[model samples]
Target: MLQHPKYIVRRLQPADAPSFYAAVRESVDELTYWMPWCSKDYSLSDAEAWMQSTSDMWAAGAEFPLGIFDATTGEVLGGTGVNHINRAYRIGNIGYWVSSKRTGQGIARFAAHESAVLGFGELGLTRLEIVVLTHNRASQRVAETVGAKLECEARNRLYFQGSPHSAFVYSLVPEDVR
Candidate 1:
């Protein structure tokens, strides 16, 4: 478990599949812009398979997938990850989602901040970017709250719910945190 009192950002486990599926089900519609893979009728089997693949990637040092947990009860609160790690460039992108019931309470901001610290201090990543759907002010706030600077507008960058939408690309460097 991570050191944060409100939440723990830890790697995904096979045992978390059920809770993960439950959270996904609870937030399916609201997460369309927040979650890149949000879609119809996500299942427990899919969560299990994803956990396996993600765990393997973390073990192989190829990527990191973190599940935010309630610090006291160890309940899976949501999911976050650093995918497409580029060692040569010392960079990675952060993607995350929070349970709808858990939103607007600073949980996503807390998790994303801790993840950013881990990426820089432990993983030695020098650059991180968070891409938020143009209209997702809540998520954009999370990105800015974590010290990432608004970089550019990525036109037609995301395809969510069968429609092309633009994204605001926010970026951070090690110095930004300091």
Candidate 2:
């Protein structure tokens, strides 16, 4: 795991599942407003399964799943990943969330910025996109902080938590990176 003063963002391990489960449990209620999946019951079993798939994807060069950790306490804060990768198009998508307690401390912004640098510089991707719920202004601000632009909105983009929701598409091209 990489250590920063405020947080650590690194590749996830199966061992982190317990903490991940606990973090999600604590944050579920607050997260459910804009993040649809947080309403469901979160168990270690599901976390383990998700970690297994994340490990496999990392092994296959198809994904990079990262867990954010608190630096001083070494607690798992939350998870994020690069998904929907298209090698031919030289593009990928960034998805992320922070634990409730850590929300306003810029952990998600640091993680997202690091991920974007990796995606563009290391992975040689030309474009990176983020799809966030329209109501998620905090996340939107993070995107803008990283220099991502507001693209088109995906109308009725997701059937989330039993309701149709629109998503704001944001993107960063290679030129947008430092």
lDDT tens digits by residue: candidate 1, 109-158: 87787778778887899999898888888889999888899989999988
What is the C-alpha lDDT profile of model 2 across 1-178, one tens digit per residue? 3467878888888888888888888888776765655565767787788789889999899998888888887788987768789999999998889888878888888888778877887788999998888887998999999899999889998667788889999999988877
| Pairs of colliding residues, candidate 1 | none
Off by over 4 Å in 2: 33-39
Per-prediction TM-score to the true structure, in the order listed? 0.91, 0.89
Candidate 1 local distance difference test against the native = 0.84
Residue 117 of model 2, lDDT score: 75
For model 2, give the 10-residue run with minimal summed lDDT: 31-40
The CA lDDT of each predicted structure is: 0.84, 0.83
* True lDDT of residue 114, candidate 2: 74
Give candidate 2's error at residue 60 in angstroms.
1.9
Scored by TM-score, the top model is 1
